[model samples]
Target: MSTVGFVMLCHTALDRAAQVARHWAEQDCPVVIHLDRRVDKASSEKLRSDLKDCGNIRFSKRHRCEWGTWSLVAASQTASEVMLAEFPDVRHIYLASGSCLPLRPVDELREYLKARPRTDFIESVTTQDVDWTVGGLNAERFQLRFPFSWKRNRLLFDRYVELQRRVGFTRKIPENLVPHLGSQWWCLTRQTLSAILQDPARKIHDAYFKRVWIPDESYYQTIARLYSTRIESRSLTLSKFDFQGKPHVFYDDHLHLLRRSDCFVARKAWPQADRLYETFLGPNHRESQMAEPAPGKIDRVFAKALERRTRGRAGLYMHSRFPRLDLENGKTCARYSVFQGFNDLFEDFEPWLSRRLGTRVHGSLFDPVRARFAGDADIYAGCLPATAALRDDNPEMFLTSLIWNTRGERQVFQFSPRDNQRICWFLSTDSNAQISVITGAWAVPLYLSNRDFSDIRKEAALMQKREVEFVNRLRNIGTRADVRVWSLAEFIEEPMENLQSILDAMDGPSAPRLTEAPRMANLDGFGQFLQNLKNQGMKPFVMGDFPATNVEMHQPTGGPRPYLVKK
Candidate 1:
């Protein structure tokens, strides 16, 4: 297998950039660095001096990076071309940043890719008919001179980056051409790299991108899709992001979600996120190596990530391409309509979510302000406290909604051995004669439109009769328990001063039978009511009473209680 070339782009991360460089050095990959041009001479000298001991590290002259500008791509293009010029034998070139940490052990990634050398890791995403996510669509400002602009002049940079600051880049979509999306950082084959660097037709792809949209974020992904004949995987990393639209925010709570994303890298972190980053880099992350599942697993993981993004029809802010799913031959893909009013930062993210929400539930990427999928998407259900509820209260729904269902076996709804509940059925608008159903993982975007009302709520009569029946379903198996519905309004109707009462009701150790299951009815009121208490400083998993949603371990009203607890 040929050696890999790592092209790292850096800006303000002086103190830690060298450590990242050292890590790549240890991986034995060729290293190429491009420090941002605007970096001060003193800082640049210090960084170069600090990294002097790493014989393999090569530094490029710093180029400035404007927050929302595309000038930065000029530096990257220059560096990429330079790297290829010097080391033409390198099999692959990967784009990364000073802050990004490799999720896989370098050897693991190398071995995984060594076997399949033709696929390009870039994603070619399409949502051409969609509008800019910001609101109004403008292509002139959205596309740029250099692809990424380093704030050449702070005033001009401010003016350039301002619109995107208030409104995100996704707010605009170009006509005719679907926005080809992928990772800004991708592992490109030497063939693709050479195509990008040596092609006589580069100007066509380049000039078109200079006027299209999201210049830097879209450049690489689009060019590859337009020119390169082969594509490997679409996703380079999974990211966490926020309103300012710069990067994803990293915090202590995001730990578990990171584990499940199965991506090679995640970013938009604060300096404080360093400690958490180390955990993945440490020797113990559960996913560090997946038992070396058959060679195709890693590629499948990457493709699936891109597929999920495409399925949701969400806009990608990067510049790589994905393998076309529909085309199958690596040349075509599914297309989605990209409209800006379709996305809103505040609407998508619940204000309460940032502080203490369920860490288990995946965040929403759909346009929130438009409320297009308000009735559909899973917004707040997967909080930390809902784990048992997910496993016990509605295991059937959970199993149908989450477990991978490609196995094709009948998924049982109850203890019965023969129930084909894995399938979700729904009705379409073809004059009420339209019937639609699907069977697959009910995760995120899949469960919504993928299933119909009939599919999701299959037992119509039983489901419609009353909330109590729904509540009873939450009881432990064979336990005759009466269930009641609770709403956030009813819970929060109590004065804030009485917040302790709610928590007092919820806090306790109950009977063994209670441990077998939980009551999962309309807990909306209950959760809504808890918001006030939560705002009052009642911890999410408060061990004692202060502000809690009320749920008690109940025994039959006619019979003795399961057990009483000491306060």
Candidate 2:
């Protein structure tokens, strides 16, 4: 039976490239790769050698692909040509990148393609579509000449482009050519590919597009529309583009969405996010075949733990001291919250926790700067920074710190009083490093500017040391009180097992029966909070809020207190 062909456009991460090749190869699909010409000769040779064992892999002619240039289109053309020539039995070709991963199993994908042998999966939009301008790219993309590469001279490039606009010089579309723009990734049948390559007007189309901006997004899509009569206006790959029209990098947190997307492929995954790849494609990925455990079981475990701890109190008071059980009307409640590094807060975690715990947890979007506490029976749950300088004098407080080193930076910590119970959650080193760059950028933006490779390496070393120091301080405090540590990665990988472990750590009864589904959280309120933050030009940070100061008060120890506002 004829199968699908893959044309992968890859630049770096040779190891990941090899894994992708192996994945498709196992499914009996042929793969043609066009590696960036900028890669060193040795690296290119090593990659080729690595894939030598994969019988169906082939290398295409090298091309130096500059951003927003015709070189990218040239590289795609080369890969498609090789696939068509070498894989004569291929019924369809799927264009993807080295970072793209198959979301569905190969067997299922093959069955889907076999059922719809003639349909093409390509995202195409005529130039007149409103969405074509969503990225703020103007009509000049098809009107002006971008002959010379401007990747290095962005300032001059902008000036030249503006100059062209002022001069009113424009290039007319060819007699019969209609402009279209869409995502660069697509899937097309062999007949459609052959027709595009063999079209008599191919040279003229190429000549016009050679000077057009980002021709890769338009060239194939336009040609595919002209040649293929049965085209589906959507790519089989799932991707999320930012305001700048750049794809959002995938991480382990995105695994749930990827599994549920029902798309065959997802793209723009980074090499550092190997955990995400492993979760979907590794040996242990088979676990995904099983059903997720009921959230009610986990909630009962939490409620039992709370009941034990709050025997004398009306409510489970987390991170608060001084029992006010008599003040309450005699209602008991369970309180649960997660506190972690600023960038480590996953959007789904808060809502998931709320749904599982049968309560509307405050979540990360809630403003922690004000530190407002609800009434005696009310639950206050949210992610907040634990500052070393701030101390809760109350002896009955319970503190839980979810420690995941997304950024290798130090977290400010204070040893809880001997009477207070503390729990420290830590992630494995591999999981910690998965989103280090992402968290580092958000937490310590000052360190990311204009640094060379060597400087970056040195900074990374410093960050690692800081992280180690922070963890050690937490361990020292563990010796003094009821301190418990839990592995976050274990919980994420095996939710049911780790949920039980967490309950055990809390001294809860074993194996509680499942209860009714918990109510959903106030997601609309969370959304509004996020919008308010954006409106105020603020974002979550590891440093917490800036120290408050009274401009009118005189300091006996210092000349003046610095009035710094949180950014």
The lDDT leader among the candidates is 2
lDDT tens per residue, model 1, 1-567: 336778888886666667667777766777788988788889989988987887777887556765444555667787887778777667878888777756566676676667657767875565453342342333434343323333346465455556655665433333334456545768788888777667676665555665443566667766676456678546555553332234555555666555555555555445566765677656564444543323233335445644654443221212353324232221101111111110110123222222222122122212122112223343322221223333344333333233222122211111110122121111010111111111111111211234553443333222223222322343335322122222223322331212223222222233122211111222223333334434554322211132234444233356543332312
| C-alpha TM-score for every candidate | 0.45, 0.52
Which consecutive 10 residues in model 1 have the weakest lDDT in total?
Answer: 426-435
Which regions of candidate 1 are displaced past 4 Å? Answer: 129-132, 135-179, 204-208, 211-213, 282-288, 291-567
Per-residue CA lDDT of model 2 for 193-293, tens digit only, reads 88988889889998999988889888887888788879887778877664445676777776776666667778878788867778767654442342321
Residue 41, model 1: Cα distance from true site in angstroms: 1.4
Per-residue lDDT of 324 in model 1: 40
RMSD to the hidden true structure, all candidates:
22.9, 23.5
Model 2, C-alpha of 67: deviation from truth (Å): 1.6
